[model samples]
Target chain A: MQANRSRFLTIMLTLGLAFFYVPMILLVIYSFNYSKIVPVWGGWSLRWYRELFESAEVWSAVTLSLQIAFVNATFATMLGLLAGLAMVRFGRFRGRTLFGGMIVAPLVMPEVITGLSLLVFFISLNQLTGWPAERGFTTITIAHITFSMAYVAVTIQARLTGMGEDLEEAAADLGARPLKVLTAITIPRLTPALISGWLLAFTLSLDDLVIASFVTGPGSNTLPILIFSRIRTGLRPDINALATIVILVISICVAIAAILMFRQQRAEMRDQKMAEGADE
Target chain B: MTASNSVSATPWSDTDGQKPLVELRGVTKKFGDVTAVDNIDLDIYAGELFCLLGGSGCGKSTLLRMLAGFESLNSGSIKIDGVDMSDVPAYDRPTNMMFQSYALFPHMSVAKNIAFGLQQDRVPKNDIADRVQDILKLVELQDYGKRKPSQLSGGQRQRVALARALVKQPKLLLLDEPLAALDKKLRKHTQFELANIQEKVGVTFVVVTHDQEEAMTLSSRMAVMDAGRLQQIGTPTEVYEFPESRFVADFIGSANIFEGRVTEDGADHVRVQTDVCDVFIDHGQSVKEGGKIWVALRPEKIHITKSDTPVTGENQVSGVVDDIGYLGETSIYKILLPNDQIIDVTAPNQTRPMNRQHLITWEDKVNISWEPSSAMLLTS
Candidate 1:
């Protein structure tokens, strides 16, 4: 009976892994296909990759997406840090509940609704204040920041909640003012959370499609928006190559994040072991 | 030190000419509908090690926080070094606290944690390093300066916290349950170390603790609190030998309390009537005639002997030994009187018997007696 159960578990695990990885594996293999017609692979070659690299449109889209992701991650993490600190550290103040609701509303709202509402709001603001003359990279970056900040806030808030208040009190008792305590004690401890929040915001901004499509204007197409528009015409091997590159970039980023998190966990475990030994 | 010099060896005892360092007048704090710290008046002399002892929610910690300037008083004034501290913030106050958890900065090394306070004051780099090193040596954690708090042992981390708080050389140091985190043996050792550090530094120390033994061992004087009210304030011996109220008597240590009514009140002595026997107190208390009172007798003060022994006293009562708890050093006997009153009598094991049998076995009729002066008359 034990052997039977083990066999069943191995078969189920393989099936689950195949279900997740098979599509990506197929896409990667076909991206190297030299066939003009998809699903009929003639031979494996680097023609699609060459074409993908040569296309200025693809390059511009990639650059625009990178810029948006960079700017969005920086600004979103800053705003998120402020919101998270207010939620966790600040005592109750007026409109706290409303502020919390407003911060979190973007997280659960539908992407289409968010995109459309932001587009309308930007148009109205342009007409009234003439600040953003036209919807483009700025609008797209702002839209991504609006939703990505909520994710960062939730991450940071969870981290701050688990942190003990004694350290801050001890700092204050040691003659450090409130601001000094924040800089010395609170922010140093929050470095790991801030890193993870920044990474998450970057990924969300880079992968965004619907929001970018609605907010972006002429000559400001992001990678996802360009890919999505091309797919409406027909399947292209260069597009597959682009998809493969996106997947590769995301995989590398995720791998880096995982490695960092693993190192942090190991350090934390060492601390835990030392604490436990002390208890003994 | 000579006898006269020793009398004033500690600055706190030089009260003839010295003024108190900290004074609290009618200090009170309220949280919502609950009064955390009721109206309390206290004076702490300089270089004195005082303790606030109570159970959880007894407001001992709240009182310490108020002195630290973390909590504002509802209506009162606190003076430190003749300066009204009501408007002082925690960071500006001339006080520091060693939290119960130690609260060592986990991200910083022990040296950095100790230097953090001096750096906040914008002290010179050389001076901050020198003071940090001195304090690290004082706490005997000089070797662990480069280690993070999490990398150090519990006792080491506790020392780091002490060094951090002491590096600033504040006028007063507040410790909340300073030794409550240690094990039994470590706690005993650390208690002496803490008291020694307080004495060597000569900084006025105010510690809050729920452990009665910790307070008794470390404090020069302690205030026992209950339900946000001060029950009694006195030296360890005073609180132990002559507790003012029944709460204090029972809270500090075990006491055999007997309820009685005062029958005779004399200038030199007082007599009280109980169900089992008439009690005689050596000193006169302010209890009125026929007033309800409680006579408390410590277990160690009660002597138990075989009934055959000729023992005659107004405070003597005969009972059967119901239970015997043979601790290694001391044995406690629970004796049941005729009126079903269980009196605990503790006897030191001065000599061991050759046989395995105890000196006093079960069902032995014993006569328990205590001196009149040993009985404390509490009117509460």
Candidate 2:
């Protein structure tokens, strides 16, 4: 009976994993096809990859998306760190409850609603003050920051609260002034949270499509927007090649992250052993 | 006791014309609707280890924090070395505190933690290193300077916390529950080591702890607090031997306290009659005849003797032994009096019973008596 149950569970696990990966695997295989049409399998070739790299449209889209993600991560991290510190360390400030609630609103709000409201806001501001006159990189990046910072804020807030006031109090007790304590103790301690929050915001902005589509205008075709518009008409082999390249880049990043995390674990284990084994 | 090193009561007892090291005048603090610490005035002499002891929520910690400038007083003022400290923030205060959690920076090495305070003062890097090395030697953690706090054991972390706070050489060092985080055996050993270090440093130490035994052993003089109020302040000997009130008597250690009436007041001794027995005290306390009073008796102070002669007199009572607890070091006897009162008496177990037999069996009539000075007379 146990053997039968174990066999059933193994089958179910394999099926579930295949269900998630089969479509992506098929797309990757099609990306190497020499045929122009996506579904038809021809002899394998790298023709579509060469075409993707040679296209000016794809190059512009890649640069646009990179720029937006970079700026969004920087601004989101700074603003979110300040917001998080304020929520945790300010004790009681004016509108604290309201700010705390509003800071996490973007995380739960529907993306369509957020994108629509931001688009309406930009249009109104342009009409009122003739500012942000053209909706392109600026509008899309702003909308991206508005939502990504909420993610960063939640991450930072949890870290700040978990670390508690003990470190700060210890610093002050050791005669470090308030500003000195912030620089010498608090910020250094918050480094892990800050780095993770920035990376999360960057990923979130880069992966967004619906919001970018809603806010994007003339000459502002981010990678997602370009691929989405092209796929709306028809599926092409070059788009498959582009997607396969994106998956490759992501896999490389994931592998590097795992290796770095493994090295860190090893270092910590050594420290632990040294601490336990030292006679001194 | 080792820190005091004085045949006299306390080393600083002769501060006839000298100013106190730290003075708290009417210091008060409130948290929202609860008064955490009521108005309290205190004078702590220099080079003495003083303790503030109480149960939880007694505001002993709040008072220590006020001295460290972490908590601002709702009213009143504090002076350290004759300088008003109301305007000084925590970082600029002349006092440094060793937190209860030990609060060593997990990210910094042990040496950096001890050197942090000196670095804040902009001390030269070489001097800071030397001082850190010197303090590490003092705490007996000389070889552990390069290790992180996580790499060290609990006792080592405690020493690092102590070294960090003491390396500053502040006028006053505040410690909050210093030995609370240790195991029972380690706590006892660390208590003496802590006192020895205080003596070596010669800095005024104010420790806040809820453990009565810790306060008694580690303090030359200590204060007990209850309900945000000061209950008593005296040497540990005075507090234990003669507590002024019922609360102090019960809080300090186990005591059999009962209400009684004064039957006679004489120059040499006073007699108090209670429901259980009559108590003859050594000193003449001020009380009118037939006035209501209270008396406390420590279990170890009374002697339990198996007898059937029916003894009757002041400072003596005859009762049936109801229950006997055979603790390894000492046995506690619960005696039942004729008035159905229960009294406790503890006796040392110096001799073992022969052939699996007990010395005092159950339901045996026994006579218990105490010396004149053993019964503490309490009026309040």
Give one digit per residue, the lDDT tens place, for model 1 in B173-256: 999998878778989999999999998988989999999999999998899999888999888999999899999999998999
Highest-DockQ candidate: 1
DockQ of each: 0.62, 0.60
Clashes of each: 0, 0
**C-alpha DockQ for predicted model 2:** 0.60
Which is the leading candidate under TM-score?
1
Error of 2 at B25 (Å): 2.1
Q: How high is the CA lDDT of each candidate model?
A: 0.89, 0.91
lDDT of 1 by residue, A101-211 (tens): 998999899999999999999989989999699888899999999999999999989999999688898889888888888888888889889988998999899899999
Candidate 1 error regions (>4 Å) = A265-280, B1-17, B308-313
> Model 1: what is its DockQ?
0.62
Each candidate's TM vs. the true structure? Answer: 0.95, 0.94
Checking candidate 2 for backbone clashes, the offending pairs are none
